[model samples]
Target: MTTKTRAAEIDALLKELYPRAEIALRFESDFQLLVAVILSAQTTDVSVNKVTPVLFDRFPDARALAGADPAEVEEIVHPTGFFRNKTKNIIGAAQRIVAEYDGRVPDTMEDLLTLPGVARKTANIVLYNAFGKAEGIAVDTHVFRLAHRLGYSSEKDANKVERDLMALFPREEWGALTYRLIEHGRAICDAKRPICGQCALADLCPSAFTVNGWREQA
Candidate 1:
């Protein structure tokens, strides 16, 4: 089959596996979501979720976060790891949002990039989830790993992998597809040891029972 055909099959399988694929990180507002995503880097969604309640309660919005005490922010976000840097980026991002965007999280990719710690991955998450715009697929660690293992892309770089996926899947499925891939990664196609036997996509996955010494493990 052609790459497009294979990609379509993978997409279908993922949709079946995750009928209600959604963002796991909980947030009520755009700014809150942006802050949550920033804290999510190098950390789990569960970890970010745990600290956000206190963080948001302390600094409710852009205006509040912009003037938040760095020490206080660090203490709250300490569980997410990289507390010092994340505190800096989250506060800096809030300051920029309040000053430049009139206290609203920038909806466009270009405007969102202006904020600190807002890279394509984080920007894509905020844009798609907050603004309902699918500018590009959010290639996080799970997406990156699954994209390569599924024969979607051989490129090691996340951007390149995202480009390959964008080319494979239609634009409309970009955001939903990303969430499904991430969920699948967590459920079955893990980094160290994928449970090929229980995986729904095992038959279609190029690396199934082959990659990462699955044959020996299985």
Candidate 2:
């Protein structure tokens, strides 16, 4: 099938499978989301969720987090792994928000990336979920795998994959599309053993049902 046809099929399947996809990380405000997204790097959302409640309780807002001791923050987030670095990024991000953005998380991609540990993935999540802006695709591991499997993009690097996805999909769909792909990846198209037979997008997935499909299979 052509790329356009495959893209259309994948989009339709995603809408059907996850019509109301959303950010899995639990948070109340933009500031909270910004911190959660930062902590979420190289960590599971489940682990991040477990840590954030305690962390947020101790340091509820930007000002509170900004004033927090790095060691204490690290202790609280230890279970998430890379606690020291996560703490540094969280505190540094909060401090920047307080100092420059007046304690408000910036809604734009350019401004969001100014904070430490805020890469394109984190920025995309914050901008799309927190600010309702669709500046780019959030190409997490799930997105990276699914996009290639479904023949939406041929790029191996996340940044290139994100760029290709942003170019292929409509701007309005970009925000929710990544979330849906993530959900699908977790539930069906897993990295080790994707349930391709049960996958809604199997028909369009070029990598479906193959041993070495979409990168080396475990």
Candidate 3:
């Protein structure tokens, strides 16, 4: 079958497997969501969630965080790893939001990109989840690996992989596709050890049960 046809099949199966897939990050507002997504870099949602409660309580919004002392922020977010850089990025982003957008998180991809530490990946998630926009796909590690394993893309770089995926999948499915692939990755398509036996896309996946597919069992 063609790439588009195969991609559609993969997406359909993923929807069946993860019928209620949504952003795992817990946040009550757009600014909170944006902060959570930024902290989520190089960290798991669980870890981000653990720290966000205290962080949000202390610095609840863009205006609040924009003036937050880095030292205090660092103490709260230290558990998420890269505490120093994450602290700086998030603070810088909040400052920009406050200074430019008047304390509101901008919805446009272009405007989001202008914020510190806000890349295409972060911008894509914020746009999709917070504002319900679909400017592009968010190609996280899971999406990158799954794209290659499923023969959707051969690009090594994330931006290139995202471009390839954008071409293959429908725009409407772009946002949810990231989370679905991530769910499948965590559930059965692990990086070091994949459980191909339980994988729904095993038959169609080019890398299924291949050299990189199996993990040593205990």
**Of the candidates shown, which would achieve the greatest lDDT relative to the real structure?**
1
lDDT of 3 by residue, 1-218 (tens): 89899889888999999988878999989999999988999889999999999999999999999999999999999999999999999999999998999999999998999998889999999999999999999988888888898998898899999999999988889989999999998898888878886778877777775745343221
Better of 2 and 3 by TM-score: 3
Residue-level lDDT of model 1, residues 5-79, one tens digit each, is 988988898898899989999899999999999999999999999999999999989999999999999999999
Q: List the global CA lDDT of all models.
A: 0.93, 0.88, 0.90
Query: TM-scores across all candidates?
Result: 0.96, 0.94, 0.95
Instruction: List candidate 2 segments past 4 Å from native.
Output: 212-218
Model 1: ten consecutive residues of lowest lDDT: 209-218
Q: How much is the lDDT of residue 117 in candidate 2?
A: 90
List candidate 3 stretches off by more than 4 Å: 209-218
Better of 1 and 2 by lDDT: 1
User: Could you tell me the TM-score of candidate 1?
Assistant: 0.96
| Candidate 1 vs 3: which has more lDDT | 1
- Candidate 1 residues lying further than 4 Å off, grouped into runs, are 212-218
Residue 130 alpha-carbon offset, candidate 1, angstroms: 0.6
**Can you write out model 2's per-residue Cα lDDT over 51-156, one digit (the tens) per residue?**
8999999999999999998989999999998989989999999999999999999988899989999999999999988888988999998999888878788888
Tell me the lDDT of candidate 1: 0.93
Worst 10 residues of 2 by lDDT: 209-218
Kindly indicate the candidate among 2 and 3 with the higher lDDT. 3
